[model samples]
Target: MSVRDFAHFIAIDWSGARGARHKAIAMAVADAAGGPPVLVRRQRGWSRAEILEVLTDGLPANSLVGLDLGIALPFADRGAYFPDWDQSPPDARALWSLVDEMCAEDDHLCAGGFVDHPQASAYFRRHGAREGARFAPEGQTGGRGRFRVTERAQEAIGCKPYSNFNLVGAAQVGKSSLTGMRVLHRLGGRVPVWPIDPLPGEGSVVVEIYTTIAAIAAGRTASRSKMRDFAELNAALANLGSPPVAGDGAIDDHASDALLTAAWLRVAAHDPAMWLPAGLTPEIARTEGWTFGVA
Candidate 1:
């Protein structure tokens, strides 16, 4: 496939926490031509639907959208996303379909339905002391649960990642991942998702990204990746060779995440090595999916 010279790079710091309009859902954009990343702001904050609208109708052609979420669950480690379950989907696309179908009634694209599903709940670590039987770390009493191969690679690169099966705790991402799958399914090929869909000759494409990778590339430690003000953020932007945005004082960490990652994407997207990681076999790409920067 020919390499695409994407015209824009967008980063979305997504949220899974309950709410109609999430303060944590932040969006930012960087023009590939040059300059600092800018936040895509709204007076009342962003809703999941609004992000979907931008993806479907508002985005410029040849944009590279980086969504900060796990696109799929751990499959290679367990041989199935839901082992011993009848409805376990065979691949990421089907998995997205399953999540969307199950979560159809979940307003705001929330994943509460899938988390509480009779069979599906058994595979997840949920809140209120509801750790499913399979939630135990395999061959161990307790620890982080199963991880996709790409996640293991992420750890290898010094980025701490959490199991997407985990629904409780502040660091867990199961809710967000499941919610993102619904959006991917709804995307319906309007914009291709990398790995899941091969890159086209010319056009926009979406890729799953772990924002922590961008933070690490900007010389920030994973533990201190969250930036709360313009001063701290501009430092990281400088590290990525991006000009500073105009701002100061307290800012949402989610906003900082989106802005910094947008700038990071603009620089990182051009690297040929970033697209092909050793861990991303065709099977793994179809099932577990790779984070864009893990290599």
Candidate 2:
């Protein structure tokens, strides 16, 4: 029910690159007592398999893990993740299963094929020139907004989340979301992902987190996308009652995100109201998973 219930808190800034290892991935952790969030892992090259290992191999019990990626598409607004498509999955779990099944042959556990699938391709903007395409074209990433209700709600509060439907661009999260689906599929019931699973008293709980939301909550609204400056990062941490992150050394956006989010979760996790958002009904939970700290 509160931060006291969990022993450890973590935030992972995930990457969706095609290589066997990705430098974009970063992780930070903090104690339940809520102190400064320390950068525990900064792997220049982390594979999806390696991350899976991190999740399972000797992880602390009763930990709250926050992953930065949309778990499901905006089914609440579009009526379906892929409207008129015969293979539209019934729920979040089924959707993950579908993505994993579709991209089963991809190398290094990549999910390039699912985004390029004939039936699903219409919904996602692929790589290459957009040519003013309404839907995400094959091999292209930019597209028009196709956000879910929660995403729209997040925008109202200034988070400005892009549709997972958009696979291209620095802001687009489509690739990571798809790849995360595969991770979720493999996680099975080992880690209880919040909103997808009931909030338990004790165990490792994975929840969706938006760094932007955490940033705003930490009073870093001016530094919208990334908190690169050391002063800004430390100020946000101070706002959350977290200690300063050591020296003014170079810190990339991903590292800053994981650090800030980890600190935010340390305090936000104590708010009992966070577990119950207004629109997080059974239907929404199944189709469009809720983002933690969005309510």
Candidate 3:
């Protein structure tokens, strides 16, 4: 859909620090129609609660808010490196096995098994403690142990009892790959989630969000090639106006712009002539073969 069709477009740059400095930079681009993207809001040092409040309050119900954080799978490494290896913890293993069995019964979800090890099982059980168990150690109190075990048993063959907002991408560098995998898993193997390479000298989170939006707008899945093409498209678009940068050696601002370009590209693809500028069309750009749909 075109920008005009969307109620609002949101971009969030997350940060984990104390006070406002730790808050994320959020930008909302409204559908001005035939005009440049309007920066309706730009806030800094926004806490998680503030961000969520603003997001829920400002945007329309149907508006799509593209966040730089991983909103499905919170932990990196798929919780694999939670000080427990080889085997899944008892609670985790049991819960996972149930999930697998349920998936087996349903054709929609994929099936998988956990590592078969006693220590690993114990660790998994301890790690995925229930509400009451969270405060008490795994086996500390009978109430905590029974409650956690019962909860694990209750969800043995389906999704775990958790919320999506808890799943944010890796806060530190050098963990994108692992973080991406966990994010995918948290998405329930359905929606398309792209894992992008980190931007040089800048936080990778922004780049990841940009790439994902671009790919979605293009009606395509992402890859290295598409990302490069997006960069080129951003440069081309920027060239159309007063340059956002002076020389070729400038900080890449393509991340957010690329997402806009991709959104426009989707608009163009639906009605090629409408979104294309004079003498600048998708065909001329040779992006016809660039499919954005998931495999």
Candidate 4:
């Protein structure tokens, strides 16, 4: 579809922590007609399955859905997602299938099984001091672990991105990205994932996003991106030229994140450059997907 054709912009602040329902999962949508983005709050919190179902059929036609997670593992640096594994999948599609199949029994779409797999576990840094032998295969000491080409592009634009291979810290996205892969695999092409799946002419599509990028676009430094109260959120919204969301006092970062990103997508989606980043090769798009706002 044309960049401006998306009828609605949706942003999901996702979580990969183990649980049947996750309070950290937040969703917001900004309409093409203009207004403050609205959050899709759930009383019992959101389940990965429920979110999948929403992507399957619950969305309005021609909506642009943004999921906050790394869509694929590092490939360009090693010429393979799992450089040491003979059976490592060739591209993002196969990698998603592999993750889904391996983590089939993992409840709430968790990726515990894959991370703990004898071979797969060797590539990831899991909890409990279980640092995989190959977590830093290239012997690149200190700093962070490996990163996808898209992530490198994200870093180029003033965003501090963690390696999808590192699952240790509070900011780590490895687990969440893996869990998201499971859901993407199950979607079965019902909703197209951009870059990996070419943008369609007239339908909804999914894309990876980093909320910090949106926050930066709203005039906050990446280090000071998280807004904890209504005052801060409204100030950021003003920077984006969006109307204030009614509220006061404290607010969950998850909700504010989703809201601002939804608004950002509304504006960012109109730019053709976002869909065609200089670093995005066909090889990279198929193997390591690109983030929507990175360009």
What candidate 3 gets wrong by more than 4 Å, as runs, is 1-5, 22-24, 30-34, 43-45, 74-295
Q: Candidate 3 at residue 253, lDDT?
A: 34
Question: lDDT for each of the candidates?
Answer: 0.89, 0.81, 0.30, 0.92
lDDT of 2 by residue, 1-295 (tens): 4534788889999887898877788888988865688887634566788778778775688889998988988787657777678899888999999999999899777888898787787777767853223364334455465787678778778877788888878878989998988998888878888888888778888999988988898886724658777887898889888899886856788889999999888888888778888768888987888899978
lDDT of 4 at 282: 96
Count of backbone clashes for each model? 0, 10, 24, 1
**Candidate 1 residue-wise lDDT, 45-64, digit = tens:** 99888888888888988999
Candidate 1 structure, TM-score to reference: 0.97
lDDT over C-alpha atoms for residue 83 of model 4: 86
lDDT score for residue 2 of model 2: 52
TM values, all candidates: 0.97, 0.92, 0.34, 0.98
CA error at residue 257 for candidate 1, angstroms: 0.4
Best-to-worst lDDT order: 4, 1, 2, 3
Whose lDDT is higher: candidate 1's or candidate 4's?
4
- lDDT for model 4, please: 0.92
Q: What TM-score does prediction 4 earn?
A: 0.98
Weakest ten-residue segment in model 3 by summed lDDT: 286-295
